[model samples]
Target: MNEGIIEGFNRAQITDETLVKMRESSARDVDNLPIIRENSAALYRFLITALKPLCALETGTCRGYSAILAAKTAASYTDSFKCYTVELDSVNAQEAIKNIAAEGLTEHIKVIHGDAAEVLASLSGQFDIIFLDSSKSHYSEMLPDVKRLLRRGGVLIADDIAYYGKTEAGEVPHKHRTIVNSLRAFIRQISEDEDFTAVIDTMDDGMLLAVKN
Candidate 1:
């Protein structure tokens, strides 16, 4: 976590004390599932503030940190805000529910327990913002549903697109080849798609931000 970036955003400008504490607490998770990095979380909070999205969808709700952040931030701007976050792991999903409750955002954020792709397929309404941060290999496979669920002019944010720099560096190790290749394919697919105007942010791993045209 960069103190300079935090100071630049200004804690008061981005989020409240409780959420900040939550972020810090979640940083020490025992299972070591990747939580959103500070810079990436800041970017998310900034986007939610800027966009004021009423309905946001998030995949990969690991302990509900990002979803809670989004819900709380959006709540500052609009009463209509609601976030639906999906998690595949039952234990993670339960933890997310508890964390959301702890944040007093249970009404604003829903933690759905299921496979991300299947859950996306079952969801019916359009989302103003859709975030993809689930399994790396599943990203490309989930694109069709993501495209379908996001409304026109909605924002799509995909995290960990660089696979910790493995996607860009030469000679990906054998074990990482699948994820690296999938992330590269996902990047290419979004970049070449006619309907989206996209850009990659290389801070804290990598994030792909695209607007549906």
Candidate 2:
């Protein structure tokens, strides 16, 4: 976590010290992988605390940081909360399982190793909250299943929509153009869709939040 964001979270009293320390430790453990940004994590914490979701789903489980955070936060409000997180890489999935176990949240957070789209397609039951943090290019492709699996009043959060600012940049580099275009399309689809009330939070890289109506 960034020192500045940590300070802001402390001042706002959005998260407890324990979770903050866990985020810091997870960062050190997975220094090479991209974990959830501090600002984004705070946003997620706030939403989970407010929603008190009984069932949650996450598309990316780099080291189970976000899943653990959500599960712990939801545990405060409900005893029946369960979170299912998917990771495509087997190595990351194993690391996520280990991390969740270290947090003593193995019972609440389930780590599945498989392609996100395939897993989402196979999943049944509606989720109260759905977090999409997988490949930016596949977001649009996965929206259908995401919508189907989210309950009518569920919240859908898509992280890294800005893709290091390239999605909204006036001139995107050639290498990033494909993902930028894909993210923009995903944003447009969610923003224009009548079923959802959507907005983009320009914090961290950027997060697209939508509520299914």
Supply every candidate's count of residue pairs whose N, Cα or C atoms clash at under 3 angstroms: 0, 0
User: In TM-score terms, which candidate is top?
Assistant: 1
TM-score of structure candidate 2: 0.90
Query: What lDDT tens digits, residue by residue, belong to model 2 across residues 64-158?
Result: 87888888788888877899999999888998888788878888999989999999999999999999999888899899999999999999999
Name the TM-score of candidate 1: 0.91
Q: Provide C-alpha RMSD values for all models, in order.
A: 2.2, 2.5
Per-residue lDDT, model 1, residue 9, is 65
Query: lDDT of candidate 1?
Result: 0.87
Question: Taking the tens digit of each residue's C-alpha lDDT, what string does model 1 give over 84-178?
Answer: 99999999999889988987888999988999999998888899999998998989988989999999999999998988789886888899999
Give the clash count for model 2.
Answer: 0
